[model samples]
Target: MAKSDTDIPAGARRRLLALAQERGASLAGLSELLGRNPSYLQQFIRKGSPRKLEEGDRRTLARFFGVDEGELAEAREKSYGATPPLGAGWVEVPRLDIGASAGPGALPAGEGAFDAFRFSRRWLAEHGLEGARLSAITVEGDSMEPLLNDGDEILVDCTERPFRDGIHVVRLGESLMVKRVASAGGGRLSLLSQNLAYPPVSVDVADVDIIGRVVWKGGRI
Candidate 1:
């Protein structure tokens, strides 16, 4: 029989709690980890009530556990027998002024470097991009408009490598640019821009530095 959304067995909840603990996450921390209200999460765990977790939410948790979504779902289903004691181990991540998102090469100015914001370790563990590391920066110009608007918060994975396709932030000489990468052969590549007003630029592979690959974009509605 298909279980109702609210009918998720007790085992599943316990396992979830355990899993969060194992991943160094606490209930209070998980709420903050996901940028959710702490009281809401407390109620959620205390009541064993169900909430529809979106794909992004699932992805966030899956990433935190270092497991895939399918695996997480299966674990939940299999572990639905008992409520385990609440275990806790969630930490917070602080936001740091790493750089300014003007094109790409614009580094942070005075009081920018070493500045940090608080974030949940649980959230970072789950949603951290693969290969590419997370680096927070505020968007600046309109050259990469529509897709990336000014003042939008972005997570860049610096550890990621650049492929011929997809948008990327690159540094060429003194200028940094956010554009599409296209292989031009002979150790060269072309940087393309979406905005018609901006002209595309070509360069040698040696001169270009891939600062990071933008995996997700966060903005105010």
Candidate 2:
């Protein structure tokens, strides 16, 4: 019997699942990335013959996998040898406003410490992070100017870990600092500022809480 409009082909779901796993995600991980219910995803994947994915769901899944929508859809149609059409759907990722990361010897969790910013969910999903919860904050002061000037828009992903030397947004105790992370001693990390005016800050491993790694930044001249 032919499937109805709402039903997705079983093959499509299998291929989609396989593609997601290939991209380093488990079913549980996918649920967290897509902000979907785990049980629902399990049931959805368990169908003897899955139905075709909805446009919105397909887009979400594709964005999560960091692949073009057509690539995901085409995998299931390999036998046919025709390229899959691109999927059309997107969501925005919001930004949080952090007034300031605790600066030198400041305590944590003080009042008026952080703020949030608004952004498009679709734009954020288009990048590598879809399921990640993000917050927006405006960059202030020239502490990190030139590269990331004051008033630049920054999107923060709290779930990501800081690994190797790269740009990251961090809250050391109560102070927020945007600096390059580098190896210190043992497991300790150093926050380096490019401006040179600020010396390298070597922090004990226990005192640092990396809010998120900075993926991208946008600001006006």
Q: Pick the candidate with the highest lDDT.
A: 2
The list of candidate 2 runs beyond 4 A from truth reads 1-88, 101-126
lDDT of each candidate versus the true structure: 0.56, 0.56
Q: On residues 43-150, what C-alpha lDDT tens digit does candidate 1 reach at each position?
A: 554564444343355557777777755443433221211112222533222233443344534643321223333344555457763222454566767767778877
lDDT of 1 at 7: 59
Residue 122's lDDT in candidate 2: 68
Error of 2 at 70 (Å): 38
Which structure among the candidates has the greatest TM-score? 2
Lowest summed lDDT over 10 consecutive residues: which window, candidate 1?
Answer: 77-86
Q: What tens digits encode model 2's per-residue C-alpha lDDT throughout 58-172?
A: 5688777776655544333221111112234433444332443312322322222132343454665678665564545556656565677767866666554446677676667
